[model samples]
Target: MALCEARLEEKARFLCRGRNPSDATDLLQDTYERAFRAFHTYDRNAPPLPWLASILTRRFLDMCRQDKRHPQQQLTESLDVPSEEAGPAEVWAGYTLEDVWRAVDLLPEEFRDVVRLKDMEGLAYAEISQRLGIPAMTVGTRLFRARKKLKELLLKKAETGGAS
Candidate 1:
């Protein structure tokens, strides 16, 4: 574990390839949690970097699969793709990461946790259910509602010019 911690930046940079730089931190976090939970299976003779890297790769793949299962279209996609002239909704064009996260932080705790686990940590609904001790159906339901709420909040933020 100490070895893994010592090489955190190295591992995170490796995880960043083919992904958003922001995802690397969350992927690294999930990998560390998984590694700690499965520490008993680690081979003491082998090096830590390769083992940790393998776990990180699996986590990224899992994240990809999860994303495929729940493909939330990017908020700006419509604005960016359509060749139409800008209108009132043109305000939706520039939602930064900070705006999304700020909106997320304002969500009620239950909704917030669901979003963070499923979206930020790249956890599957089942894993989120287990982590939060909720039924799988509830995880799905909460995630749906949370996403709806996030969209509303973000749109409001965009309309208001990035105000909280």
Candidate 2:
């Protein structure tokens, strides 16, 4: 319990990286409560962090669904943005990591999960599959598509003179 409490903030931040801080806090608390209640069921030999992460991820997804924050809305908004015609220099001028993360947040849930697992979390493909409960091949496909979409988005930003 003390160990879980110590890691609460880190887990919350991981679960809510692109979300409102308040939402993150709520989810984190819920995750801890859930984890504590189910701690007895957890296999002692298995990796606790990943198990906790998986639980939190599912909880977060449920929250999103309950809140009715449709991924389709984000997808529509992203698709509406016109691509930029500028070169790489103009495209990367104001490209802070936060901006990149915001772009990642705009991705559809499936693609966004892959990007977060692979890029932000630095998990291997196999690990990502286990965490996401998807096949390894699906992880690869989602990652490829997510990268392509992010590239397109950044290019659009550059072309629209909004890169900076």
Candidate 3:
């Protein structure tokens, strides 16, 4: 546990993203418990944060499923919606955040970086350019392309009932 304590804040941040902030502690505890059971499987040579993060992400997804809440009512708040229009929100209501994240993970590395930085981390174009060492115009271009590709991938996933 000592080795993991310092690395948990990032997991907590990930847990709270687009999720109910109140559940962060509970989810973190649950993930820690899971990690404990699986600790023996971990190789000492590898870094722990990525393993812990993987556990936390899967734990959160499992909790969402076990609770029977995804695609029910939580969708109203989980997705990025981007606007007040119920049309887009309702279309997204059937998908869970995990489903969205899975699609994001499928993007090319550079596109994924741009999307995560801009959307998930809430970085402005200028900040993203500075961090990524790319032109601000390139940031906008990547974000636009990433979002358009994301829409296509998500639509495919939606057609397959999120199995894609």
Q: Write the per-residue lDDT of candidate 2 for residues 1-164, one digit (tens) a residue.
A: 56865576677777666444566788877887898999999999986877787788889889766544444333323333334533444345457666777888889999999987766655678999999999999998998889788877877776677764
Q: How accurate is candidate 2 locally (lDDT)?
A: 0.71
Model 1: residues with Cα > 4 Å off, grouped in runs: 1-89
TM-score of each: 0.48, 0.46, 0.46
Q: Which candidate is the best by TM-score?
A: 1
lDDT tens readout by residue for model 1, 1-164: 77767587566767565344566788888998999999999998998888888888899889777665653332223223322233344454566556777778999999999988866676778898999999999998997788678777766666666643
The residue ranges of model 3 lying beyond 4 angstroms of the native Cα positions read 1-90
- Model 1, 69: alpha-carbon shift in Å? 14
lDDT tens digits by residue: candidate 3, 1-164:
56676567566766666465556787778878998999999988998888888888887778766444333234324344544432355457676667777888999999999988766766768999999999999998998788778777876776666642
Clashing pairs in 3: none
Error of 3 at 81 (Å): 5.0
Clashing pairs in 2: 84-156, 84-159, 85-159
